[model samples]
Target: MSSENRTAGSGRLLTGLAWAVLLLGLWLWGREITDGSESGSSAPTTGDVAAVGRPPGVALPAAHKPLKPAKPQRVDVPSIGVTAPVVARGLDTQGAIEPPPYETPHTVGWYGNGIEPGAPGTALFVGHVDTETKPAVFYGLSAAKPGERIRVTRADGTIAVFTIDDVQVFKRDRFDAQKAYGPRDKSRAELRLITCGGAFDRKTRGYTANVVVSAYLTGVAEPRAG
Candidate 1:
């Protein structure tokens, strides 16, 4: 081969080698990330529903009757001025809750094994505030405060009213799953709202804290007979 042709061939070989190295590095980096567990960084903290220990904020006797599904249709709280649609589902892998569909727009997560809203015990709901991709449904949840009036309208055209007792923020790892799932005063069913909060980690692209809203059912609408 002539000198110029030989030089051109060498250049192509170098380019191919560089591309191979780049692909190898990317694969190694992805493997390390997937194999490494994300522990310690997600320990639940105060304000987490899990913080509710054997002695909860307010504990009562076992539920009088087993919980039944009250499938909610709409939710309204005069206190925070939130009137959103209700969508209820089971838990997600991350353990954060989802929200119902409202004009505001967001997925509301529900507890699969817990009491259904309008049931005889506490019901649970959760949603995300913001992810790296999109903002979650419960993004405005932090704005809620105590003494707020919350109302949920069911598919049956019945409305259930709840009073916001308080709001708290807990670390991801310190989240108390038990407290979130435990029964409340037992007089009326309750609802707990959850979402990501606290410090934001750019590296992990997630919130270190979780916001929880504790509310109790004040009134339940009687179902209409078929």
Candidate 2:
């Protein structure tokens, strides 16, 4: 094979391998959630600092009725000062969800195969915590506390307003994918924002834990008049 062809093939192989490892981790997490046999505890943290969980007396809003499915166009978290464009992402050839390209670290990847942002299911979104040189879009995700709002603008010209209820950091060794990704209430439109958390491991070239922020639709905003 020519040098260019060889490089292309090698790149594909590496991508496939990375996805395979991710799929394996998810499978293990699902099993742990289902069977409840995992023994490790996951400390809640973000970027090496302790995260704020739902404190006593902090009441969140009730869930709003699920809206018609629409693709997400953008996501905004005012508390953490995040405003990023959302891009539809699908499963790789290995059936694992693909993340946004490293070149576009500011973009968020929505799992297009899952429920839409305003639909009555958990809509999954992922972002990079940091790149080799700088913090990425969700670098401060762990600092978000319960009762904050997450606004998602959809293609239908409506905004889905969600209230944060949970922030957790699951250790990669004992991550629970079902608990992290599954809808907290099947009747409510929920959203999950995930990124790498805890400390970065030099040996593995990855983070020690995954930061998951859980929120549910609590209100809706009509599109602004043109």
Candidate 3:
């Protein structure tokens, strides 16, 4: 793996129909990351007041540890104040990991055929950066930083805590699907929060890059449910 992290910039450009088709074709078998887009860095207002946005500076965390398998239910990122439901998604007719429908813009989709979130592998989770009317669940993902916590509430009633390690925005033409989706730590429980990012080219009617937020499981907890 390369020991470099690339900083990102820019915003959304996908049209309604194009966005839908692109997202649906994202997970095609043996395919790499082809397209995505999102808004520029913005302060998070979803979690606690103290959980404001931080710069994605030169920071790294300890190696992530792997854990037993568990089905995911929801995801919470307090630093960015993101709390959203998760839905299991499989490949579409075109053999791509289908994305959540546009109507359910706030929901995220996890690859159902892949390893579970807490398992000993990189669990892939994705969401739309925006819609025709507004930003989606992952709209603010560009603001995440290393060492922040990403909590995944599972069906077993336990929460899998992952620590952010890196965030990168790869240009569409330079995007590497295998490298982007492959496990950096094969034995550790890792996570990648992906969305569209980078400059929006009005001429192409699409985003010029994709935002990737990489993290790994550090611990597990059983917090009381409200």
Candidate 4:
């Protein structure tokens, strides 16, 4: 993880779709200790304000220790013909992960700060569905449906296959935190791919909502010897 927190910058990037799984107390205490700023009456924004500080009425859920996935280093969606190398870097000082070349046309992998991709908990993977001018990596992602396969090729050459469970679109302002970040049955692992969706919002330079595809791990394979 990098010593410098990157949220101040990336937060602005995913202004439409933001999530914070880390406990609220940890967030508030960290802010006080690191920035020396007293808490204020800041209403939750469309994005995850859980990152900024704990919201007044929302109490952080009980923490659940995450079971690390096999460490997915590559992302491949054969259904939509997506093959991209993953990048590992602390997206923000708060410990949320960042995807690679996010500002570019193609990149895949977990944002390092949040749950690890393929991990037991809900792992978040995000990409631009479409840029302001060009088609982006996940532009076709909305077409993927339940039962489609999403594979992650690890650095070690192993691959994990996950079956898509559901896909839905949500208005940015009405995005449900619990549905996006709340804890779930840990017996089975889940994955979430989020990207800008719906219409473009000229006022905010953000999408009107987000398209999310949820999947569950079905298989894991070790690197094959050549």
- Best-matching candidate per TM-score: 2
Please give me the total number of clashing residue pairs in predicted model 4.
Answer: 11
Q: Score every model by TM-score.
A: 0.58, 0.80, 0.75, 0.65
lDDT of 1 at 146: 63
Instruction: Write model 1 residue lDDT over 16-82, tens digit each, in one string.
Output: 2122222322432443421212000122344434332222444322322323456776666565445
- Highest lDDT model number: 2
Which candidate model has the greater TM-score, 1 or 3?
3
Error (Å) of candidate 1 at residue 126 is 1.4
Residue lDDT tens for model 3, 142-222: 788878899999987889999887677655665566556667866678898877765455566566566778888888889
* CA lDDT, every model vs. true structure: 0.50, 0.72, 0.67, 0.54
Q: Give lDDT for model 1.
A: 0.50
Clash totals for all candidate models: 22, 0, 9, 11
**Candidate 2's residue-wise lDDT over 68-163, tens digit each?**
889999999999999999998776665466778867878998877567898887788888766554567887888888999999999999999999
Range of the 10 consecutive residues with the lowest summed lDDT in candidate 2: 33-42
- Position 25, candidate 2: lDDT: 41
What is the Å distance of residue 142 in model 2 from its true position? 0.3
Cα-based RMSD of candidate 1 = 16.7
